[model samples]
Target: MANTMTSYTDAQIMKALLTKDFSGIGREFVDDVITSVKVGAFTGAQNLDKVSLPSVKEVHYCAFQNAAITTLDLPWGELEAIGFSAFAGASGLPQNPVFSKLTALSNGAFAGTSDKKNTDLRTISLPLWTGSSFSEGSGFSNSTGGIFAYCTALTSVSAPELQSLPTQMLYYCQALEEVVFPKVSTVNSGAFNYCSNLKKIDLGGAITRLGSAFMANASKVTALILRGVTTVPTLGSTTFNSTAVKSGNCYVYVPKALEATFKVASNWSTYASQIRAIEDYPDICGS
Candidate 1:
């Protein structure tokens, strides 16, 4: 039964949300004060497998942290932000959930693992993303987790318009295998940390700088395609120190004319043995 007695105190509202009963809560009340889902409102709502999100613009902290949400009619264009741990423990979301116009995602916004899986690029979009790292420049610090950390089912991602990747963007996504960022110029620190299955990175012509620990502990990365990058990226001693790229086991495929340049560049020179002209890998990276 809907709690029809409308006037509610702070404690009463908390009790109503905790009980998972919002039936008779009139739309007027919802639109005026509950525009956003209250924090921790549905944290463990196991029966909440589908969400009706048309009236909601934002989801507050831990609102549905561990809910059984498998489907939602989310207004992607109108939804602006999702709070920290909003869907952290929900393991039933689709592998390719579209975020058409979303602008902000707090730490661990969708952190937990899920059973739904796939390799879809448009699953997450950031054409309107304007948030910066909460732990900016402090690459490996655990202070801020990525929007999709520990998402084991997500296998791939491609953000063609993104220029810079924040720290730990896809940290510990064990199933992630490929990344396509044609216009990305700077991949920040620890962006792909511990992604064990990651093998291909197509930075194309735009990448200029790779931050500290950019691909740390990503041992499966065997293909680094910089098709038109004429200038070697700024590489420090530990830029790729912990990845397969630094150990001479992977191939750094660059434009044919710049093969020599990469082989002789600063830290890149150290991997001269692994540097190769893109033309030679026509079967793998195309001509």
Candidate 2:
């Protein structure tokens, strides 16, 4: 009589891998099967030049680390979170993956990579982040770390639900021209430290704490409009003193009710001549 052998189906093997069960399957058997399946799936897929994973709703940590994926087109609108160190050291992938649908990024989501050279990643629309904690050096760093760093063409950003501005979010975006933080309530330190060309900053009536060096060394900021601010904190001896505020030439506007409070602050008092109640100057462009 001829000898007989048992065979397992692909679904059975995949289920075993997912459950981490190797009772009947040998270690080599599992490894060989997984490797072959992955290779075949990647090679047989359509559009090998531009692989688009639209069905992937969530990506865990190190999901694609050290892989050969050169380009990723993640356009899934349902993607809500990216695990920590998810794309860390993914040298083969582009610096900026086109994700027109990604809404949230966990801590260190794209950390530890030296492949950001000549990357054109300028503008991002994070409209869903209501309250998020970005630790010190927890977010993007390095020359390629700024949220919109080196994006020479980036001119404007509109986020209606953004409650806090993370530290170093716009660290070295030298070409940023305008930023509209309509709902921003808190601004951490060094938020816009080295933006040399930043010209217009419109902080709408919701900000409370302006951390140290919030806009330090941003000489090009010609207009600062604080529509509902009651106080401007001091940064050591320098305070909020800039050529724009010291010359008494730059325009400063405040709410009508907070005129007394604004006139009492030492930083604002020096530029008192430049301050005007918002109601009095309805037509002024820079407030």
Candidate 3:
């Protein structure tokens, strides 16, 4: 049942949202009033994207189980956190919404979507998350056993602000072919579990930890560049498990001066068969 009240204060607005009574409520009501939207507020809304709340600077744990949202226009600068499964099961969302100013995202924030054919979105771009950190089971997880298991059409990602990735961060994005994570440091288990199409991964020199990070995507990865890195991280028991690339088939490029050092390092010695000097591959490491 929807509330038909014509007038609503912020408290009433919060109540109306929590109770699923959005009768006379519209964008005008929100833009004219509501300044912050927190968790448990938009737990189950039907059509909120129709309204653009320029006045709202913070949106957290909103838009849960909603089936009819096509566009969301929020003031990202004023935004704080997008809690767990905030927009899960919103299968009809066509493209990735822009969140240029968001700082934090909890697990599975936008994970499970509807299984309707043609409903699978193509891309998700987060251009501004300079100070953000993604917790476990977050980013994009298909909690329902591959129902929304992967963003098959997702080919590009630009998350330079990411400092670390929790478990299964981009676990099953099979068609993902491009990624740009310039400052990532720690990678937990299953971080890029089955990204079969991403052929190259550059963990830059700042990487110091790898927690079973890449167990299954090793075959498709033709190049593994860890430039400027001098030390090897604590490798998991299955750090390079079940990789199809035979010895000499794939290349692991380390800093030129550290090539020999890596070959003799613990855990790294497992991939010594595929190891090479970074300078050997000018395409990846400029001469």
Candidate 4:
């Protein structure tokens, strides 16, 4: 007697694949033993390495948790919202080689240590990210939850359109030397906690807030340029204590409009001489 399980309908197979229903008959159905998988009835699997997802138009939770996906290339799309731990522990995908296409990433979309072993990623470009996570001092700060935390080979991040940085986004990228922030509006706490090699931080005129410990423990950052910042919060004590900001060895350039504010602030007064109201100067990182 031979095994005689009935074949599933195409609609059923498709539903299983889209939902990741890897159980019982569903598993055997997608094993490709008898039929090929399809996306929304489309049958060609060749050149399908990149799959486009429907724009999540509403607030949803855990959209893709523990998924087996290897890469994602979202095009001119917007994620309305994401639940906590949306992309947590996706251990199968490799480091993204081209991240410029991603316009937005929801909170905790790529959180946790699931993919820490695959650290070959070197470059990233997100042009439209505006969330606080994009701010160098927010929750996405280098010492806290940055995706590339401890990724020593990362050299540069060119996000000219990013408006904010979550805390600790690039906290300990030891090899990072240069960064270009175009439309940044805020830098939150612990943004670049211990990036020892970061030498230059150029902020456009949109920034308004500077959080606590924004550049703490970065000994190599010698020069800083602030053009559009108007409200300079108290530069927290012990923050930058280990870096050039400690012994008044680093040069801090501020717009003339902010010269008075820096001079008045008690925390900034100590370094007032090092802080100059200048328009331009040589590259901070010796590039």
lDDT of 3 at 90: 54
Cα lDDT, model 2, residue 218: 70
Query: What shift in Å separates residue 250 of candidate 2 from its native position after superposition?
Result: 4.1
Highest-scoring model, TM-score: 3
Instruction: Give the CA lDDT, 0 to 100, for residue 40 in model 2.
Output: 21
Cα error, residue 266 of model 1, in Å, equals 1.7
Candidate 1's displacement at residue 142, Å, is: 14
Q: Following a full C-alpha superposition, what root-mean-square deviation does model 3 have from the true structure?
A: 5.6
Candidate 2's C-alpha lDDT?
0.51
Off by over 4 Å in 1: 1-14, 18-35, 38-50, 67-73, 76-78, 113-145, 228-230
lDDT of 1 by residue, 71-187 (tens): 644565666677777777764455565566566666777775545322222256556554432221233222335767777757756455566676787888888788877766667
Could you give candidate 4's per-residue lDDT for residues 1-287 as a string of tens digits? Answer: 11124465666645545556534233342221322111122221122233334332322234444454444333223433333334444333335444434544544444444334224446655554555232223433222145445555567776777777766677677778767685777787767767788887777655655777788888777777776676665576555566687767677777777777887786777777778764545344222
Write the number of the candidate with greater lDDT, choosing between 1 and 4.
1
Ranking by TM-score: 3, 1, 4, 2
The Cα error of candidate 2 at residue 249, in Å, is 6.1
Report the C-alpha lDDT of model 3 over 1-287, residue by residue, as the tens digit: 22233455667566556666555456333453455554555566554544455666554553444534445555544555565555555544546555666766665555553252223456655666543433324444322112223455555566666666657666667777655566667666676667778777776636676766453664577776776465766666566775544434567777778788777778777778777887878876443
lDDT of each: 0.67, 0.51, 0.58, 0.53
Clashes of each: 0, 1, 2, 27
Steric clash pairs (candidate 3):
57-78, 108-138
TM-score of each: 0.73, 0.62, 0.75, 0.63
| lDDT per residue (tens digit) for residues 1-287 in model 2 | 11122355566545444543433333212122111112122211221233345445655544443333445555434566555445544333443343444555544344332334223344556566553422224333212123433333344455667767766566656667778787776777767776678876766745565676677667777666677565654423353555455544455566778776766776557666676677786655443
